[model samples]
Target: MSRVRHREAVFYDYFRQSTKIIVQAAELFDRIVGEWPSSKPLIPQMKELETRHDELTGSVIDELNRSFITPFDRGDIYSLISLLDGIVDGLEGVSARFDIYGVNEMVQSTRQMSGLILQCAHELDTLFEHFENFKRDGVVLEKVKRVSDLEDEGDLVYRRALGEVFSSSADPVHVLKWKSLLDKTEDALDNCKHVTNVVHSVVMKNA
Candidate 1:
């Protein structure tokens, strides 16, 4: 490949690698919520993924600064990587909260929300897989839409979860803890959709 093509490919490589970390983080979060205390051992693993994601984010920024040619708009590339990093950060934050807050049991809605997050993460992974072909392939748009749909599902689950937490819990502290956790979880899902939104814009601009 020519030098320009090779440089362009590097951005795509970063995107693919970033999405894989997001998926891994999401899966770990899902498992942690599903298994509760038994999954506490995996909390550290989520932090490791978050750290790896941070390093990947730094690598992308460094490459962007060093290279003259990029796969897409420089602003879009930066936004995409920043948003991807946010997803992992949000996951790590939520996972750490379980231990920090001394959460004894996992709620059903928490599990449900984590599952939705995992679904969104997988959808995002698939989206990036076809992103390099965004100009030629139609699947890119479809994947973007799928991520949006999952975000909407997450919103619904979050609302229901919040309502339950407020109504069912008598302790003010319990309600506050869950409310914070749900918000963070929802933010992760929103970040996934934000990445796709940026990708959609890049596709449209190129089209």
Candidate 2:
């Protein structure tokens, strides 16, 4: 392969690695919420996932500077990487709260939001699958729309979950706890949609 093609391949692989990090973080967030064990192993799992994401982003930026021509715009690549990493930061922040805030008992509405986040995360797996193949098939745009739709659903669920959390609970402190958790969970979903937007932007510019 020519040097240019090889460099482009490296960039492609780096972007794919970053996308993997986004999906893994979202998935770990789901597991933490759904399978929140008393042992609290999920905390470390989430931290590790976010750490891997950080590593991938740093590598991408390093490669970006070393190469004169890139497959995609550096600005978009940086934005995409930052947004994907945002979910990890946000997810880990929420998961750590479980241990820090002494939340032993779980709330029903919070669990519901957790379940929704899992579903939303699962959708990301599929969306990124097509995205990883977009270079060959050009089908990621279609899947991005589907992911965006699920994120919209996530927003609706977030509102319902928050309403239940604030109105039904009597303890102000407990209300605050679940309220923050629910908001973070919803923010994770928003990050998923933002990932979709990044891909859509790439499609528009490249098409």
Candidate 3:
């Protein structure tokens, strides 16, 4: 491959690597929610993944600065990595909150939300896997739409979960804690959607 093509490939590689980490974090979060107090032991693992992802993010930006030619717009590349990093950051924050709030039992809605985030992360992984071919592969757009659909489903789940938190909990503290958790979880899903939006834009612009 020519030097420019090789540089493009590097950006795609960074994207794939970043998404892989996101999926790992999502799976870990799912397990943590599924196992609740027992899962407290896994929070550090999630934090480690977050730190790993941050390092990768810095590497991508460093690459972007060093190269003259890129796979796409510099701004889009930066936005994509920043948003990808946000997903993990949001997850790590939520995981840390479970410990900070001294949460004992798991909320059903929180678990459900975590499951949704995991599904979205998997879709994102698939999306990035196919992203390099966005110009020729129609599947790229389909993956973009899939992430958006999952985000829409997440919206419903978030609303219902928030309602449940408010209506069912007698203690205001419990409501506050779970509400914060749900908001962060939902934000993670939203970040996934934002990444797809960037992908979709890059595809359209290149077309």
Q: Which candidate is the best by lDDT?
A: 3
What TM-score would you give candidate 2 relative to the actual structure? 0.86
Please provide TM-scores, in order, for all candidate models, with all chains considered together. Answer: 0.98, 0.86, 0.97
Higher lDDT: candidate 1 or 2?
A: 1
Model 3 RMSD in Å is: 0.9
Cα lDDT, model 1, residue 1:
98
RMSD to the true structure for each prediction, in A, is: 0.9, 2.4, 0.9
Worst 10 residues of 1 by lDDT: 123-132
* Model 1 clashing residue pairs (backbone): none
Candidate 3 segments exceeding 4 Å error: none
TM-score of 1: 0.98
Candidate 3's displacement at residue 121, Å, is 1.1
lDDT string, candidate 3, 1-207, tens digits:
999999999999998999999999999999999999999999999999999999999998999999999888999999998999999999999999999999998878778888888998998898889888889988889988998998998899899988888999799988988888888889999999999999899998999
- Stretches > 4 Å off in candidate 1: none
Preferred candidate (TM-score higher): 2 or 3 = 3
Q: Model 3, residue 9: displacement in angstroms? A: 1.0
